[model samples]
Target: MVAWYDPGVLAKTGLKSLLSETIGRQADRRLLDAVARPQPLAFDYSEDGDGKAREELWLDYVSDLGDGWDSTYAVASAVMAPTLEVRDATGQVHHTEGGDVLVFGGDEVYPTASVEEYQARTVVPYEDALNDRRHRPHLFAVPGNHDWYDGLVSFTRLFCQGRRSRGWQTRQQRSYFALKLPHGWWLLGTDMQLESDLDASQVEFFRKVAAQMGSDDRVILCNAEPAWIKQQVKPHAGRGFLDNNIDFLEQRILGKRVSVFLAGDLHHYRRHENTEGRQKIVAGGGGAFLHPTHLPRVDTRPDGFVLKECFPSQKTSRELTWRNLLFPAINPWFAAFMGFVYALLGWGVAANLNEGAVSAPPLREVLSAALQSTGSLLVAAGTLLGAIAFADDRRGKAWQKVSGGVHGAAHLVVALLLTWGVSSVAAPLASELQWSLRRDFLSGLLLFGGGALVGPLVVGVYLLLSLNVFSCHPNEAFSSLAIPDWKNFLRLHFDKDGELTVYPVGLRRVPRRWQHGHSPEEPVWVPDPRDHRATPPALIEPPVVIGRSKAPPLTLGTGQLAPALVTQDEQPPAGPV
Candidate 1:
């Protein structure tokens, strides 16, 4: 099963209480200042008109306030996975304030978010932390893609309010909300409107509320996806409003009064200084899978932002260092180990088949049993690795490839080993049956002929099936004869030059761009594309010209080739002349 957790939820649950309590009042105040300090007057100016000016003013007013001033305030946002601690300018560790607004940036449930899905993937780990009172922060959530898997109604019902309160009013429960925090910090939550059109009502509600807010009050906009960040960093053509919401606030509403714009969805934490103008913060690194580490190759321009890492103050707090070594649970090294095990099994099967020694039971039966067991084990391991890969589809590709390749190779080896053993035993078994039927001359003749033909046919079919050349279909007259051990008949042969030269089992097609030789000096065969649709273009062979005389046939081996016999002029004879 795939496992995941929200670090933001855990932090709210009080897992860092040891650090929180230790950081005390002084450290707490410092942390608030670090995050909420008022911007310089020059930095507060908006490029837009009065509306932008007013928004900047509002943000500035909020930043100037002390923590004790806010009452009944809400900071609804999503994807806030906090680390264990936040350190201040003095290197003091201060635990995150559990009482602050905890917004769940969309994708509360990953892959697909159903009620049961969330219960299994999200709620289990969140509840574990909450049960310990390690997280008590007020949670306000906005539904992302996964939450809509079973429809937004279920998500709103479970998260916005209890299930017992089912109705149209409650259906929109979690999608939108207004939080009034202590000291007048106002947080507004909105569901990610993934549809092409926005809800007219929600837009009007936002416009009306912002108009009523004073220049001194703080208003933080929260959504699952960062509409503003995407606009500034990676602009989508013709999608103005999606990114223009921030500009609207700056130009149409607050002017230069807004304080901060916070969001979560990227699955990583970044603090971008709108030092050019506004403050945009993305706190997405909350217990979900980390984002892809591969940065864009053509990063000529600066990303237009800076990032800061915050942790609790160690001096003030009791230095609560959490050992989360077990959180991710699976590691790349584990996958490599599984691969090694698969290789060992393949080597063993090959060794047994080559030895050809049968003791108590028939060699065919023993080999069959061993191959079957190994194949089963590999299948199970592949399933497990696939699950992990599905959890984080980005990084999981390598793991899936390794595991699948091993399983595929194992199946082929086992099938071939069993086929060899069966072929060896078939002749003796057929001879015994022929002897038993000798009294009836015609019956004996039929028996002997049938045995001779059937023995090789069985081996041939087995070989075909092992290499995946023959289809394994269902509910047909030939279903009983389906070869499950076909994987064994396939042989993957590598050339001496360390290139895969041949696959002599099911499919005989070579992979694209690969050739038979290690170096350019060796002879290479190029398959004509027109002759076979599956054949790939081959490598250029070394020159065979004999200076106007015909070149002799070349002798080829696994790695090296021998030169043809030549006359005094160092030229091969022309047509034996």
Candidate 2:
């Protein structure tokens, strides 16, 4: 359904992105703060007088969502945590359950991350789902890139304001917050940056959070995206932004370790146990296009971390192919016709095999064909590249323009040569086609249109990847695609004994249409007895190995945020963790 060259999904709403950049963000933040009046909560895990307030700690997490489509409905249903009867291998019937805390990892919507978009896309659907529920859990969230596109101003009003939108409310004073779970456990989430680090204020906030923890405290850390999976897939792992942050938090801030890591950027479910004995999981399938879980790896590239488990496993054979173009609403901002355009353009890039000796059109026709094929993709990639170069230009001198020009020329030359070489190699075969095939206009189109993807797909895909190495975001090397598969999430429970049991629920079936609102399909209890990634045995589990996070008890002051947190139009502030 998704290919590097088939149909390019262009990111739109450039005007909104521009407005947010120039003036809209400040105005939005000011308006939201004045009208909504958010007061973020700051709670400490160690401060829980007694851990027995609740028998079990229940929480449901979903991330990278907010597209209003069938898939979105499916995800909303998945969040409902409906009762499902599944027969175990031994033929015993069992039902999986849900949690008391419902959290969203981020990316609540797409295309123009403004306030108007969230009320309908981010808040309404979930509100409907929650209202539809018999039991509703308290909701909390961390900001993802799409959410931050408007500088998190609207997200603040929509979710962070003291008042609740629907039933969802954010109590955290800042974008990042900490939740004290049962059994000396903590859940920490951050408002993250791309290719950047936490600002000094955020670091100080978390440091105070760290000061409150006893040395033996356990933490379940959450971030905006499931970056670890791409650690090996991309040339750089989250541009080392997340890893540095995590290291700083554990080593510098807390002087301790994290028990688990959860994130949702890639839109699928996977569980990996890192060499450090921590369970890193990706559960972004909260109502968005499903990204393929597996990717091709060059033989020479040594494998990165091995995934302990994944829903839609290797047996499922999920792939990124052109057939996905048929799915409507996959690209909400771009028209489906654009896919055909990308496809035709790819074919055009290779169509020139008949430009000379064969009965092909003139130079004008070839140029026309090539231009049509690459027009949109080139503009998109060029716009992104131009922004980056301009950023560089601002930091230095006019020389950045010269450097950019030389780089462009070199890349253009290489791209043209590769295209020509591939075309030349295939031209010999093109010359021998049957006259019936050659003369039939419809037949010729049917035969050659597919290759049009190679035009922009080739030059643009490679360029997008090459350019990504220099920074992050808008890199094809880091893009994902959709698939028709089960969406999933993680539900964690902490019992009286302080042992944790993680139930990874997979919604195997997505109904095509439903009259009554969709509910969660049957959930599977991922079986892993000895693995720390899953639930350990209740009675036989090893004792919690954490050290006291802090001294006997520290009399912490008020919340770290002064008047408020995140007031400025955000800049990419760099700090470790």
Candidate 3:
């Protein structure tokens, strides 16, 4: 599980941001750009071994990958398998092979980006899946926010070296590149870094790529973030801001030739399509912790693209949001930290405990004592402010401020009430015992236990209500759960006649049990066959076809129409060929 809410991870993320900002100030990294490497005019894979224009091409788009071993490896295993036969809703099986070109959309590693992290979380899993394949896929990637964490030094070194992993070849010189595919199609991947804006050098690089594109040529623009959906979430940020880099590239550089906009920062599958059949898709569910799909309620984009489909439908997402009620169980370390805080707050109150009357202290006296202690006051103030800052602004900025105030107030009120109640009860007993060591120990035990047990529950319930009732904290609520299911990726096929079809592949559950393979021919690790969670891949939706006047019959790499689409009158094939 990638504990996004974990304090250590959060601290590291903040530190990364600080360091990146410092680097940005000292030297404009993007301008210096892939520094010594010679920029390629364009990587043209439009031809076959005979130097003739190829009739077909297959590509894979995956992003937001590289989290835990179980989740990451599960997705990698499914993707790297020689072929997949996924059954759709209507029992139509969609059979497809690993892409000739595997493009990582963005955020290849999570929490933080580094050589070790990528090697362990990403490279190792992918390499282990298919070690000795004859025809290896070419891999290209654009840097996401996570990839930008180390100032992109690690990303540039690992990916831009033009080296090869066990089962894939790295082909891009810079963090971004353009691939000229067959049948008048082009794939352009951009590195947005953390700013979500392209540098002058990047803009010029794309302009050169655009210069090579014919007017009728269609393009698949890959970005690190989905600006269309993001406009709805943070209306004033990124591409939503008038004439941002994305708007410029779409409007000026690529123009109407950009038939498809693909991105994957949000860890889910969503497709927004215009009436003209242009598609904006987000398929970020490679291996990271699942993000809630029932958020921002973006039924439409400003560009007139209507939301067509979302994997783990909004209803399922809302249902999954309810799991935050188990936050204490999911994040026991955080819960224990909260317990320590409560213990400190309680100790502050108990330290004021003197030889008072044998009876319980009055409520006013308890409150007064707590208010006088600087430590208690600071803790209460910090809790109130931190809760306020933690609130998500999905509804609006004003609503966020109001909801946050109430949330923080609830915590402070609970603390005050608990302090009063505990002090009132314990004062009588401490006075009777008249032993400082025993009294101190009892107070410490009580406060720590109470905080540990009660504090996390309060937080969990607050998260549950905020998300279910108010549509807030979608990221926070779900990240705390660190769900490893609902992983997905896109496999696209461009057939002989130039028609393109996208098969959205998904897995309902990731296998938890694994064993090392004994032979060189076998994968490094295989899922335990007895694991109940081992399920076949399924089509997230019917194959989405593009650029054809009418829907064409789907075909496989063997150049035959797919055998998986059986009619009611005919029995399906025994298995995928």
Candidate 4:
């Protein structure tokens, strides 16, 4: 059961609360203190350093994970909008509520991360949750691709600066610092250093950090991208600051000291135990649109991952699973059904074009005329149905409503006119050009065009008729009847209120009613009302009541009926007996 709320509102409120509590109070004190002491100048480090130096430094920082966590310490990472929360082995809440460190994953803003993007994406609901937490955890972040879309200068300047001053340590804000936790837990911050390259010095720094770790302790590496996994699949891709340093650490310095690799970029949660026997967790579903999932194939191993649990926060946890959810490409059943229909229509057209065919001009003309008339009716009905379905009731957004109506009407007119024109003109042209092209080509083209145009109308009419039939006499038995040939026969139907109704094929006569409240054990016979060729009854009787005498039988019909069931207006209702 996921908790739902307006994410924008939630984020705004949260950020306001956090600013008021943490930075706001600090700023107030600084302002008062400023009267007595002068404020320091803020520095912009962008121009002072060369690109290569900066890149090397970034790599060095990521490769090294200092000695494992101290017995009393836990390293907290704040991942941006991680839809899923982290739980310890004992099921203790480690994220969402509060954590030791905050890791800001990339895409802080969806689609693209810009200044406005931050206001729209990151600042809202996340800020609210951050403010509500009792613990004020230290924050560190790696730049996600979206964060870097505009470059890392903005992100670094905002988080690294302290007291609005510049310098490596002083200029950097307190919000983006590495902390040595109580139990020897060392947390490092890398602010979207994906583009930079790592140097030998940085690799040495990582080695020093790894050397300090013990068997009982573990080092946790954090980043926006899963470089290790990406490298495994695509080694040719260049290593960034973090990747270069990680390569050095994995090959030279750290043998097995590093245990956990945490990342959030793919937009889907995944946990893979790499060949090195380390847990790689990707917690990306942080209120962002879901990513396609990858299904397990013969070439892919199960890899020991399975969905373990889902939390009320819409957070799902899996046991070492590597899954990718893929979006549906095409529905094969729909294609196959349409193909069969076209084949049948093509055969009919081919037979009609036979040179030795019997002379039956009257029958041919009548059939063509009937088809044209039927096509017109279908187009008109479809357009009206589409218009009704597309109508919106929510008021006040006048432009949206008007545009929607215009779109619906346009589609309706196009469908109707197209159908009528095509049916009327198609046969005559085919007859005239019968000698110009091969019989198969002309027949195939006509069938394909007609099927494409009529598919929706057929589906719509079938659905409407089916609903009318079903509503006429509702019963449990009717519910059990499987809609026959629904794929082939039924047309999609839309009601005035934009509700969809589907009528399956071969769903004609109602089956015998079973015992009261008891469903039939076997399948029942029902015709699909979508088969346009079939005719249904003009009028149907309304539903009837059938209940035990002791329970009090009730009758159902139009308007008011069964006065006993209705609440009395003149007198207060009696207390329950």
Name the candidate that leads on lDDT: 3
lDDT of 3 by residue, 442-496 (tens): 6676777777767777888888888778767777788889989889999999989
Off by over 4 Å in 2: 1-41, 44-52, 81-94, 236-246, 274-277, 296-306, 315-481, 517-577
C-alpha displacement of 528 in model 3, angstroms?
A: 0.8
RMSD of each: 30.5, 10.4, 10.5, 29.7
Per-residue lDDT value at 551 in model 2: 24
TM-score list, all predictions: 0.38, 0.62, 0.90, 0.36
**Candidate no. 3 TM-score:** 0.90
lDDT of 2 by residue, 440-516 (tens): 23223433333233333433333333333333222232233344345666666677677666666555544444444
**lDDT scores for all predictions?**
0.34, 0.51, 0.79, 0.33
The candidate, 3 or 4, that scores higher on lDDT is 3
TM-score of 1: 0.38
Question: Residue-wise lDDT of candidate 1 within 1-577, one digit each (tens)?
Answer: 1221222432332333333334432242222322343211111212224433221111100110000100000011011112223332354543322222344546665444456655654544333223322333345566654455444545655665523211011212436555433222345666544431234344444556666554445545556665544443333222533323333333333343344455555533333343433345444433343322112211222434443221111121111111122211222223233334334333334334324443223555545645566664564466446434322112245534553454444434543344344434444454566754322332223333332333223322332232222211111111112111101000111122222111111111222222333332221222233544332111111111111112122222121111121226534334321
Minimum summed lDDT over a 10-residue window in model 3 is located at 554-563
Query: Any idea how many clashes model 4 has?
Result: 52
* Model 2 poorest 10 in a row by lDDT: 535-544
Number of the candidate with higher lDDT, 2 or 3:
3
Error of model 2, residue 100, in angstroms: 1.8
Off by over 4 Å in 3: 238-243, 394-397, 424-436, 548-577
